[model samples]
Target chain A: MEDPMPFGTALHDRVRDEHPDLDHLVRVATRSGTRIRRRRHAIATAVTASGVAAVAIGVAMLGGSDLRSGGEPDVAVQPTAPASHPVDQPPRTRAERAHARALRALQDAPVYVDSPDWRCDQPLDEKFICTHGAASVVVVWRPAETWADYQDPAKAGPETFISDVHGQFFATVNAGPDTTHAQVVEVGEALIWAE
Target chain B: MITDAGKDSEDFGDFVRATGTQLYRQALLLTGDHHLAEDLTQTTYAKVYASWRRVSRADNPVAYARTTLLNSFFSHRRLRRSGELPTDPTLGRESSAPEDDPETRLDLLAALTILPPRDRAVLVLRYWEDRSVADTARDLGMTETGVRTRSRRALQRLRPLLGAELTERTM
Candidate 1:
């Protein structure tokens, strides 16, 4: 019996012969590039405008004499907290402050740990683990690190704590002396940051 | 020295002219429809053009282009789950009413449409493009063993549809 190479070659040749001309491919590609550039420019403009508007609103709210009557001048605005919880009088205990900060960082994250018994535990020096039912996340507070360290956690050092939930693994790593980053990575999926 | 942007555009245009037809052929085999194949080819070229600076610098740009094309095809397939070419009974009847040299080719393509996208990709890359099993695995983002298994299974599936004449020699 002969090899199937001839048959495969014939098939390839037929398909190749049937392909239409490539004159329009370059045109389509150029148009696509233009479209992408326009999209990026529009997004950037929107982001910049939003940032400016937010800053203006913030300044207008804080600079108004009525809003700043009794509060400390040095403290920035804390929009998230209730009116009763002033920025100048943050949680007094270090653990409470850390927990608050962790909650703020993860406020916009897609996944949430929904157990009623969730508690943050400091198992190691400057390391906190919060668990609720099957879901748990560990946050490590580093003193002074660069953003690059957060981007490449593998180079930062060994993982302090790792927890697996729903086939996704979460790890906390010291990015720098002052920087800590938490990341969740699932197999065949992109790395998602908890920041 | 040419500016980077000018050089990138020129290189991309040249690359498209050089290998566009071959990529279109591969797309045709993968899609089993001429229109879909053309769309896939154009999309692939557009991606390559967008990433021209990096892709043109790659050691094997052809392989990179092939990988990009396969990725575009698979992603397109994923986005439109029910949008694959229809294999209705009427179309099957029309396809069975054979012509001369085109009959065997149409039969081969018809059989190919039954396999899953990844399996079809494996077969086309292995047989039509004559890629090594390792290369096919890498292109499909699968293990070598996975590629082998898919290739064997794809051939088995095709044998019945393709009949003994086409299946006997190579597969």
Candidate 2:
């Protein structure tokens, strides 16, 4: 302690001359901080992706619930339209009554769903489109082309079924995931043409 | 990949390489415990590295790192020594080396332990770091007058402890 300088200088000299384990400490600190930052960035990305997925699911659900009500078809079967066939002869065949019943069911069917489902649409003037849940049935008033079962590529479901009901009417049932083959046929058979 | 983040990390590592020794010495003066000083120095660098983008953009990154170390010391001053004293096993090895006045070193550490953390910080910045009254004030977030007063009072407190230690050594 000879010529012990002022306490401050002595203190500074004591620290300034000292050495510590620098390599290990600096390496650990830098690595730990960078790892934590990368973890936070990954978590943020995952949260953003999940948020987008949730919004898409919400929009899809809202679309289905939007048009769930049972309402009249876009085109009603006009009773006064010019008949293409003789009107006085009553259809006495068993198949004739079934076709008329199917047309009646079409007039009683509900409102339309949106693009995600088998959305009900009419491509012809005399055709009336109606929906039941995810399933749809299109009724043609006069003799028209018997359309075939067509797959809607965008949706995951069974193919649609189109069949001429009697001699003068065509019934097309769009089969959705919720509807089976027999269920779609039943939907086609639901149409009626009662006076 | 040399992305912005990668560059920031590289720059931070370089900064640590340049300033780590000086900062560790400053921590040693502040805490008077080799292992504790090492811990404090590592923690300070880690905080700076975490916000490397902002820290690198600062006018004086060394000053920024010093402030963070001081703040951490003030907040967690009683950081447990894991049931140990201010001295550590490493200093025993350090004391045997040449120019190691073990008794004088012990006296300094014992003297520092008498004062509270704020007074210790004032002494460290003023004496060890050779910071001006104004610079010490900014580092400790105190007024210049407060730095002067604390430095005066802290020295007044340390005098007798050091005197007693020297007398004990002479006997």
Candidate 3:
């Protein structure tokens, strides 16, 4: 059999010659038109306004999880390390406390994940905002000993909660009924669902 | 972030008018079907609109647009779960009949259909646009040698479909 023709300028010309309305195609592809843009802008504006109002009211109700329930325990930042001694010192700032909590959480958390699947497939239920059917690892934090050594039953965070969709990082923040707490999670490439 | 409406539209319009035809041809070759080509083109523009501020400032806006289009194509493929895109009119319009040899045109389209999207793009960029191997390499992010290799392989695959006469006459 004769060898297949090599694709080069000749082939390009042939395709071009056959299809003359090529510009229109690109135009059609890239042109979302003004209406779509306007709609997108309106939606974004509304969302921003709502977000501002939420901040003003000192409460942000993100989709999923009912943070307004009365029985919910207060979510507080955990300490970086287990207390060694009663060394009298200035109380840590909120930012300092959150950072220390993140560092300690990373260092001392005990998770029994052997594979990526085990890590990602941890159950998330109606009470906990997590993957219902999807797989994800869970990271839980215990509150500081001085305040109350409690893991708020209503609060859960996935310190390694990588999305199995857009690969965007999402740290769960459980701030009780009125305050906000967050977990720093890393977004991994596989979370993009390349497969 | 200068977001002047009139200035942006005019600049985007000029860019579209200048590069639209070339992009269409490239899209047509990549998808083989006209409607899919149009859909690809339109999506490309929407993306350009979304990032027009940064894109307009870049020295190689065309390159940015092309990459955007390619990424869009790949993304659609992932969503659709198949590389075999539809030729439905809802996607894009039918190709216009050109005053050329029908057999040659058919042969070319047939040959293009057999090649992978990237290979088709390489040929379109190389020949129709009259770009150097280096320029094609730069645009497609392939090494010069890789471009040459793909080009050779693409031609070799197209030769049999085009037949001996077409190859000799065209080459």
Report the lDDT tens digits of candidate 1 across residue range B13-100: 7888889888988888888878778877877776677567677788989888898889978755542322344343233233323333
Report the C-alpha displacement of residue A14, candidate 1, in angstroms.
Answer: 3.5
**Residue A19 local lDDT, model 1:** 50
Name model 3 segments beyond 4 Å from true: A1-195, B1-3, B77-99, B165-171
lDDT of 1 at B3: 94
Clashing pairs in 1: A142-A178, A143-A177, A143-A178, A144-A177, A144-A178, A145-A178
* Candidate 2: residue B46 lDDT (0-100): 72
Candidate 2 wrongly placed segments (more than 4 Å)? A1-5, A39-195, B1-6, B81-100, B164-171
Model 2 chain A weakest 10-residue run by lDDT? A108-117
- For each candidate, what's the DockQ? 0.16, 0.15, 0.15
- Angstrom error at residue B19, model 2: 0.7
The alpha-carbon lDDT assigned to residue A188 of candidate 1 equals 10
How many Å off is the CA of B118 in candidate 1?
Answer: 0.7
What are the per-candidate TM-scores when only chain A is compared? 0.28, 0.25, 0.23
The per-candidate count of clashes, in order, stands at 6, 11, 28
| Chain A TM-score, cand. 1 | 0.28
DockQ result, candidate 3 = 0.15
Candidate 1: true contacts recovered, fraction: 0.39
